[model samples]
Target: MTALFVDDRYRGAHGIGRYAREVLGRLDVPWRDLGLDGTPYAPLDAFRRVPGPGAADVVYSPGYGALLRAPRQVLTVHDLIQLQTAWPGRAKFLAYYNGPVRRVVRRAGVVLTVSETSAEAIRAWLRDDSVRVVNAGNGCSAAFTPDGPREAASDPYVLFVGNTRAHKNLDVVLRAAAVAPGIRVRTVVPAAEAAEVRRLAAARGVAERVEVTTGVDDARLAELYRGAVATVMPSLLEGFGLPALESVASGTPVIHWSGCRAVAEIVAGRGWAVSDAHDAHEWAAAMTEAARSSRTVAAPSDAYDWDRTARVVSETLSDVLG
Candidate 1:
């Protein structure tokens, strides 16, 4: 069967965008790209405007382009963070989720998710046993290897990669840095959020110990990963923790919250999981111990390959088409 892949998030730099670019690049099927432009809602417009998929063709979206109506469509839902978390745009998000997103889930032939945890969440939220949800997992990019050139920091620092979303629980890191002393916390965030992170650090009384860097390229990110004492992920929820995997691949230890099952499962033997994400003292002790100990290194398993992911997608689509 032929595939019509939706390239909606191709130009974006978020995890969903990266996933789209990676899997679409390695897919083994004969496929054509359908690009979407304008706002985040543009996909709906594109979906309505584009010609419908033929009987032998399947329309696949790596991101949640669920509004698109096609003969056979596959959607990958990363997480329901907006639904679960309390945010400023809850009203708008709820409206969209209840409107187009729910419609997409109802109409999709097969729904793919990043982890089993996410699959369960989707099933539980939708309360639908008929929905076909599968776990496709995630992989670290090949660039984050153990032999990369390391970046230099004035003092040993624990690295935090990802946006400063409320669920990320960065306040714990700031609190831990305040009490830990001597150990710096280096956070990679967008330029717009740098000031807010700094303000939070000051509010927590650890401004001097916290350093925030914005707009780092991949090479720099790898270097930082290589040199960090340990990468910290205090997120309360995650579909599939990519940062933890990347850190382990770079020969750096990772300390993530145990509450995030996906992160815990991904970093099982290669990293440490703290049971109490809210306890600053516990995280502080863990960070200090990680800095003093030898870096724990491990290579990603064969399962973390884009080729494997593509194969799974291909097989799933074939099953749906059959």
Candidate 2:
């Protein structure tokens, strides 16, 4: 069977692109890369031109952009942040997603989501309970493991790995670090937002203690994860807590916020959870514990490997096609 994988821009973002590549690589059946550009479709014409199950045999979309006219179509919904959050400019974001996108989600033969939290949100927002929740595995590379016996940096520091989005809650981590005075905190933000975050850090008087390094390659990122005293992620939400898994794979302990259910599932009994800090005392204690517990070993991450994810996706596709 030939499957048409629909995505607006295949290479635009790293996360969805990575997942799509992995699934496609593992699929047993032949697949076609159908994108919005250069195809015989107008800009945003993907919805109109999308081949149905009869034409393409089956359709698989890694993201929630495809509206299928075919009998069989599968789409992965990573998160429902738009439905759950009431942040500034929420109306604008909700407007684009409310009508057409919701229809695609409702009409798809199979709706795959990354986490139960997301699955619940989909059901609540779209008012459908039939969506299946599949947990995508997040594994650290062979590179994120202990790098021989390197001396810990003479200075004490904490680390955070995420883009500068409001949901990430970097300020909470920074505030926690500030109250802990002696501990320095380093964050790897996106290149475009590094300057703005740096300016914010300076204004907050934690400038000297904060270091922002942006646009790091995979090797450098591995080193950063391996060498940090601890990795902190105070995210308000996550589809899957990839960084926490990465921290465990690197044998680094983690301090995570308790807002997202996926984090609780991933770190349950294995890692520490910090509730939204009513004050700095709670955060300070969590950071200290994470720093001290830096030698945690998070092996056996193969359960969540790309191969496993691919196999599940392939099986689902096969069932649909048959």
Q: For this target, which candidate reaches the highest lDDT against the unseen true structure?
A: 1
Top model by TM-score, which number? 1
lDDT per residue as tens, model 2, 1-322: 5554545344322455556665665767566655445422122543565543455466677766555364445777777665556666677547546755666656554577666667666667766566445544443445566554432566667788877777777877777777888678888876787887888788767888888887665567767777777788777878877777766667776777766677666666455678763355677788777666655655444666766677777777676666
What is the overall TM-score of model 1 with all chains considered together? 0.88
Scored by Cα lDDT, where does model 2 land? 0.65
Q: In candidate 1, list every pair of residues with a backbone clash.
A: none
Q: Which stretches in model 1 have alpha-carbon errors above 4 Å?
A: 1-5, 41-48, 51-57, 68-72, 87-95, 320-322
Error of 1 at 215 (Å): 3.2
TM-score list, all predictions: 0.88, 0.83
280: Cα error in model 2, Å: 3.2
